[model samples]
Target: MPNNMTAVFLPGNKQVDVRAVLVPEPGPDEVLVEIKASCICRSDLSLYYGNAVISGGDSNQFVCGHEPAGTVVKVGEAVTEFAEGDNVAVYLAVGCGVCHHCRVGIHYLCAKWKCLGFTMDGGNAEFLRVPARNLLKTPKGMSHLAAAISTDAFGTLFSACRKVGVNGLSTIGIWGLGPMGAAGTLAAKAMGGRVVALDPIAERREFAESLGADLVLDPTAPNALDQVREFSGGEGLSGAIDCSGQTAAHNMALDAAAPMARIALVGENRETTIKTSDHMIRKQLTVFGSWYFSIDEYADILALIKSHKIDLERLATHTFDLKEAETAFRMFDNRETEKAVFVR
Candidate 1:
């Protein structure tokens, strides 16, 4: 193994610094992974703009990439479930293991949560050292790129769709056809839901359509909700997911859903107004928030990808080497690409 490696850091104000640093050594319960692929996320822009989304995200001293997949090259002495030569993907949340949430594998909800790429050194580098419990085993034949996207992008939406009970009989509406909404289209379709993807951008709508969304509409159009109702056979949407974080989208999803239908809020909006008896009480809806999938759900996610032959790489519109971190983040920040990845 090399004594030193290249890592990327976002020191706020859109600065991306690629530096040479020593390869990290694993702690007693950690593992050192030789990173093969690492994906950029929209939330990473918060760190770029200096208004970090997660707490301590503005402290750009650490490596900056949470969505990473690679091979285990070295294992700490206490690591038992994984070893050298095992293919894996890194999960983002690092929590206090003894917490009630962590015991059940929902580490992100723990009180002492420290996200990768935000609070600590993450994968935008040659190697990533993380706790053994945070490693997800990727299936054979799955490319590192796919494995990386399967984390925060595809995996997050997949878990949300599962929560919404997307299935053969569902006609779900997904607001905002960005990367997350686009991934929702793939996951919803794979699970047999007829997806009605919405976005103001023509290109994003077309992308969602290409991803097999049953229908795509411009949410800004006056007849957008009408189209959704028409498409759903006049029964209203069976379920809905708001990935845009827009107040209008949230309200639309809440008001357009059928009675007893599930609604998932996957977007990162700070606050929005909601009608008590109108959108919720009258519809008898089941509203919930979904972040990353549980550790227990990783196996099912992999199986769903394999069985459905989901083309996760399609979302990775661009790929770059670690040295090109600046260009990659620039394009991604300007919305010039969907999923931008750093690959070895």
Candidate 2:
């Protein structure tokens, strides 16, 4: 292997370039992973559009990527659980294990938690050095592309469902049809919850239906909330998840949720707002802001995949060579694919 490798970067809006950089070395508690596949997430697009909270200013020139799966090439002396040649999925949130939140298994809430690809160099390159604590063992049968999303997409969805008290036989309303939303549908279905998916795009709605949605509705259609209500026996939904992060979807989620139901907001929308008096107080709803997954939930998600309960293979729609990252990003930006992956 070469001493250095090329990685793609978005210096500004619509400006993506591949540049050569030195490969990272593992520290005492880190592991060096030779990236196999890295998936492009909506948050990456947000960074490209200058909308993400973590930003690398124009002068800083950051490496852009987050969701990645790869083989461990080297292990730090302090890392005992993982060794060289182990296939793994990389967790973006690297938290200080000694922190109060980390001690409670809430790594996402760790004050010093720093995300890969955003606050640090990420897996858009040939290799990356990540804290060993952030690595999850990839199941034997899973592909690199499928494993790439375990940390963000599947993990996050699982966390959201758990927060909302989802279980077999519960009715769920999903407010977006993107990759995460589609994953939610599958997850809810795996747990025996019937899903009602809502999206503006016809293609997304169709995708949701193919993924086992009990009902797929256009959020913009007249009586969309009525459709959701009808599906839930007119008592509203048992729980709702807002994956679109749009004002319309957020409002619709509030309308669809049953009294005292949980609503998980996974999307990032700046202009969205909910009236505290309109439904929050009247219905006594429980709202949760899902940031990411806790390390404890990763084990459950992995078990579901290993046992064939959740199918992630169908979620990856496009794959590109590392050199074609710009094209992949453009396709993702255009909404031409569900999940775009960079395969090394």
Candidate 3:
């Protein structure tokens, strides 16, 4: 193993730093992962502009990628279930093990949690050191790139689709065609829901159509909601997922939802206005927010991927070596690519 490795950092203000740093060593319960693939997420842009959304936005000094997959090269003395040579995807949160949230496998909700790539060093490097509890085993045949994307891109939406109860009878309208939205489209379809994917960007809409969405439309079109209704046979959407985080998309989802519809808000947005009486109370809607999948859900998630023959790698339109971090971030920020990744 190399004594030193190249790591990427987002020093705020659209800066990308590829620095040489010592490879981290595993602690008593930690594992050292030789990162093979690390994905760039839209949330990373918050750090790019110096206003981080996670870890309280107080720091951007650590390595900067949360979705990473690789082979475990070293395990601490306390590690048992996972050993060197195991393939795994890292869970971003590190919580005190004894906490109720950690016990329930929702580490991100732990009060004193440390987020990888936000508060601590992350996997945008040749190696990553993390607590063994945060390791998610990757099954055989799942490529490093797919495993990486599976963490955030697909896993999140998969969880969201489950939350909204996507099924054969579902007429789900997905707002946004970014990686998350695109992943949601696939998840809904795989779950047997007919999907209507909406995004203003023509390329993104086209990509969603290629992903097997029943229909795709420009969200900005004057008759966009009409198109969604038509796709749903004028019954309105049985379920709706908002991955755009835009106020317009949020309201649109509510407006297009059928009576007794289920809605999953998967995107991160500061604020959005909703009509209470009309969009909620009278309609008896079911709405909830889904962040990431529970650690235990990975088994079913992997099964769904394999059973449905989902090619998660198709979501990554661009890949780069760590040295090309700047170009990768630039193109991603400009929406020039979907699911750009950093490869070792």
Error (Å) of candidate 1 at residue 232 is 1.2
User: 129 in model 2: Cα distance from truth in Å?
Assistant: 0.5
Worst 10 residues of 1 by lDDT: 51-60
User: Compared with the true structure, what per-residue lDDT tens digits does model 3 show for residues 247-321?
Assistant: 899889998999999999888897789998998899989888889887777888899999999999999999999
Prediction 1 global C-alpha lDDT? 0.91
Over the stretch 113-147, how does candidate 2's per-residue lDDT look in tens digits? Answer: 77788877788889988999889888787778879
Q: After superposition, how far is residue 337 of candidate 3 from its true place, in Å?
A: 0.9
* C-alpha RMSD of each candidate structure in angstroms: 1.2, 1.5, 1.1
User: Between candidates 1 and 2, which one is better according to TM-score?
Assistant: 1
User: Candidate 3: which stretches are off by over 4 Å?
Assistant: none
The lDDT-based order of candidates, best leading, equals 1, 3, 2
CA shift of 171, model 3, Å: 0.7
Give the alpha carbon lDDT tens digit for every residue of 1-344 in model 1: 99999999999888889999999899999999999999998888988888787875455678999999999999999999998999999989999999899999899999998999999998899999999999999988999999999999999999999999999999999998888999999999999999999999999999999999988999889988888889999888999999998999988888778889999999988788888798788889998888889878888888899999998999999999999999999999999998899998
Return the lDDT, model 2, position 307.
66
Clashes of each: 0, 0, 0
Error of 1 at 296 (Å): 0.6
Span of ten consecutive residues with least summed lDDT in model 2: 53-62
